[model samples]
Target: MKIKAINGVKDILSDEIVYWQKIEKTARDIFRRFGINEIRLPILEKTELFARSIGEATDIVEKEMYTFVDKGITMRPEITASLLRAYVEHGLQVRQPIQRLFSIGPVFRHERPQKGRQRQFHQVDVEVIGAQEPQVDAELMAMGQMLLNELNLDVSLEINSLGCPECRPDFRKKLIAYLHERHDSLCDDCKRRIEKNPLRVLDCKQQGCRAMVQEAPSIVDNLCSACEEHFAAVRKQLDRLEVSYTLNRFMVRGLDYYNRTTFEFLTTDLGAQAAVAAGGRYDGLVEQLGGPKNTPGIGFAMGMERLCLLMQQQEGQQEEQGGADIFIAALGEQAIAFAAPFVHQLRKLGLQAAMDYSNRSLKAQMKQAGRLKAGFTLIIGEQELEQGRGILRNMDTQEQNEFSLQEGAAMLAEVIAPDKA
Candidate 1:
């Protein structure tokens, strides 16, 4: 039998890797500007970490997680729990009152894969630990919005309030009552979870389940004074920044930890995976996950696969030319030997340079340079080497110029260096 990548998982080949790098680079640059440092957590963590933090009743813990049998370890289906483990384990809150950390990595899930969803998917998680103010929530949301905007993605922001432990009891009571009224009509999964996780029905994708919950009471109207005020203040901050958004009452995110504020960045480009990014504020999670007494946190996560899917939908098979700024083509053995050091010096001077070592003919080497889409080709032939000169051929326009090999790095730097304003 021929070996192959498992179903629902696909490899990101070299040709498609440029887009991934561009996405990662854009995120890193924006994250730096926000004072959010990167945090790398393990791919696998104790099953108890997720079970206790994300809620054992949640679908992730009950169905999707890839757990081991011998020991109680599981591949992380999400990052928040692992990050919280690191935070509490390292006592990060003691070092800094406010911790802004982000991570981009693969997360495992055992689920039916479709267009964007996968068995092994990547998420860019941004978390702000040790903050309770609504502005922090708004700032995280704004930063996420800014990232998608910078990527030229046309996505809409939807925000919701799930209330806090103080007020959530009344809300859940009302929600359960409404759901119980339509219990018979609810989907099987919805029926089983109605009394336990009734809010989940609102976010359910099943058509029957969605129709049943449409007329159900909105959580917004049920928010208590403190939760209501926080939601109002968050909206006020967003309005102050002129960040347009819709108040989505149905967005009770799929997690037990999320409370007060939850959000999703939705895109119509991808079918089932509409949410390109989603996150919320979890106030009790730190305490729930055995952290400090009361460590508040807010964060958002972007699915790389979904984002790439949307990007590809917007921009088709246009290849980004991944090439050096200069390609050195040497004619003979002696010419090639001289070209190697020349290329190295150009690299040392911060120029992206490449050369043919096999001594391919001048015509063939020039063809290789053209394939690389190199900006300029420094051609060193037997004659040029004896004269200490190389013909520089422009890849774009079939123009050629001569330069001294002794002045290679300096000479190339002068040409490729960005112009001063």
Candidate 2:
């Protein structure tokens, strides 16, 4: 019998790791620019935290989350709930009136994997907790725009308001009335969800269900005066900032927590997995989850896999598979003995240098160097070691030259690192 990786989880292998590193670095730099502090939360949390915050009726809680009934814990399906849990547990509001926090980590679910959707995926989550102003919502969306723009990705932003506890009920009533009129026409999943979670039906992908929802009333039309005012303020700020956005009535997030504002960064390239990032305001969530009442916050989480997918589709966008800077091919016993310290000195000078550890034949070592895509290969033979010199070969041009072994760094710098030279 053979062992294999779990069906839906995949490995980030060597050649592909550089791209992941680049994505993480870009997120960190952009996040830093916004003064968002990085937060590290545990992958496992009390199951009740999410069930209470994300709502038991949502797909994540009822169908997708990886719950552990016996241990009373569950792997987090998203970071927002966990972040909120941390905020309450640590009493973050007391430390600062507002906190801008971000996290980049893996999240787990039990769904079948597809091209851009994985059972175990990663997300870059950004949250601004404790602010009730619509300007913060506009800034959050703008920052998302900037991050994707920096990545050279083509994506569009769409936003909707989910009307808070004060207003969502009337919209919910209207939504349910419309959904009931066409309940039989909807898919079974949607038919079941309409009564318990009508907002979920609006996001259904089933063709028949989507057609049925097209005629249903939008929450925007049913928002109470307060919600309407808040929604208007948010759009006004976004307009002032020149951040273009579409008003997507059907873009209600799949969580029960969201209210007042819900937005997503979408791309058409990935079929059903269209949203690269999505989030919203959850004014009632902190109080709902046993924190200070009326606490307001907004956030967004970008799927790393989907972002990478869109990144791969962009024209002229190259995958950065960083190769070795220098390879020291040590031949003969004396040359092999001289390899370690020689490579160390090159590295101390900031060169990514490596040498043969097994002391393979010169031909074999040279082949390895070529395989590694090293820019330059240094050949140190017995005679060269005795003479305190080594031959440097340009792997690309196959041009050969010599330099003092004691001056290996300076010699390599002349051709490869001219600035250092």
Candidate 3:
């Protein structure tokens, strides 16, 4: 019996890897220009790391985390907690007051998967640690915009402030009071969230819960003096950078650590899964997670699977060109022997060289070359071997040229890739 992949997970085969490669490449280039360095972390961490950082009330901690109860380890549902854990454990603050870092990897969650979401999904997380200035928040959003722009993705940006510890309690009380009045009308999830995390009810998607919260209090209106100033400064800097954005007062982060400025990049192409990227400030989290006191941070993560889906939707699946730069079709056993080493030499010179090992007929080999979409086909038959030359045909133009067989790979490399040769 053939085994099948488990539900909520799928393989990214060769044909689809090109989109991922382009996304990663574009991200790296943008990160480099922004002076952001890369970081890598383990997939598993002590369950307490998430419980403390993500908050036990979160859906990720309550229902979605893939935890081994006996082992006390859990697969990471997101990257921020693990990154903050690293920052504190390694005393990264001693080396630099502020560190700009990014990480690319898969994060595991136990959600019911749908289009653009999987049990194991990839994300590109960017963080600015130890920077509390409002400009840092603005610049981070700008960096996200630049990355999406370079990818040619048309996504809208929405910003909001979740306030801070100083003033959020007032908003929470007011919100909870509002929720309690309509308690029976809310969804079971929102009803539970009312006490544990009243803010999450504002983010609920259910029609009933969403309608209940339409008249709810806005956190942006409840910011403390300091938080209000910081938020205003963030908006001012974003304006200075000419980064366009709309205010979303009801926006609330799924994680408990977020505070102050929060934002998401939205797209209409992905149906209900509208957010392609999202993030916010977490001023107190570094200290909460055993890092030095007052080490402020803000970061964002782009859902790679969602980004790829948007890319495929905008440009067809086969938009990226794949296959060999050149295909060597050797007709006879003697020709195959000669072409084998010749192809290897071309590869060493930085060329995507492919040759069929099967000693098939010339017509069959040419057909294989066509299937590979080879730019050039080098035909070496008994006749060409006798002539001490090979006929290189430009697959596109169908123009053939004779090259001295004795010169071998060097002569061919120069012809195919003049810049490299």
Candidate 4:
């Protein structure tokens, strides 16, 4: 019998790390340019935090969250609730009236794993707290667009407004009534969603449920006067920024906190996981979680795994293995002792250097240098030690130059340095 990883989780091997690093690097650069600071949060929090923020009736809270019932703690299934909790507890609001923050890390969920979705997945979450203006929503969506564009991903932006509490009750009532008429045909999930969370029916992926809601009341049309104006302003800002988007009347977020200005970046490349990134405005969430009242917020999250998958799917996206600046091949014990210290010297001078510690044959070491794609190889042997010089061969051109052992590391560092070259 062999020990194996958990069924729903995945081990990200080194060869696949390049794609992940690219995604994270591009996201961090984008976030920096947008003035968003990075934040780190714990992987676990009180179960009530999610129950209060994600809605107790939602599938995430009811089925997916990995909760320790006795401890009342859960491995966070999402970043927003824990982030908000930190915001309130640390008095981040008092420090800065408005916060522009982002976090990148893994989150947990106890759901069936699929290609781009695992039990433990990573996300780059961005949030702006205490900013209620429609421009905030537009800019946030624009930032998401910029990030995906930089990543060279083929994703489209879709926007929707869930409407604020002022007018949502009436719309919820109407939506519930519309769902009731098709009660017999609704999927089991949507059927139950009617009374507890009618808005979620519009977000269902079931073919029958999707068809049923095509003619259902559009939440965009029923927005209250304030929400209508706010949504219009958001669209106007998006137009000013020249950000292309399509209106998705049926787009409703799964979380309870979302209201008005919802959006997602979707790509057809990923089959069932069409959304590569998604989020929306949650005006009352901070207050609901014990923060200051009326603190408006909006943010979005990009799935790292999905982004990496898309990167891998793209033709010519493979990352070339980086080569060492220099490789030293030492023939025997004396040469090994001399080459070892010289390798460290090159590294301290900001150069990538590699040398075999296994004391392998010169031919084997040369092969290792080729595999590493080393730019140059310095061959040191007992004869060379006696002669006080070594042969430096350019791996690419096979041109050999006499390297003086008297000057040693300093002269070698200058000779190999790109700027010096």
> For each candidate, what TM-score against the reference?
0.95, 0.95, 0.98, 0.97
Model 1 agreement with the true structure over 55-91: per-residue lDDT tens digits: 8888998999999968999999999989989999999
Error of 2 at 311 (Å): 1.5
Q: Is candidate 3 or candidate 4 better by TM-score?
A: 3
Name the runs in model 3 displaced over 4 angstroms: 315-318
Better of 3 and 4 by lDDT: 3
Candidate 3, residues 29-51, lDDT tens digits: the string is 99999999999999999999999
Which candidate ranks first by TM-score, i.e. highest?
A: 3
Give me the runs in candidate 4 sitting further than 4 Å from their true place: 419-421
Error of 4 at 325 (Å): 1.7
lDDT of 1: 0.88
Ranking by TM-score: 3, 4, 2, 1
Q: Pick the candidate with the highest lDDT.
A: 3
What is each predicted model's overall lDDT from 0 to 1?
0.88, 0.88, 0.93, 0.92
TM-score, model 4 to reference: 0.97
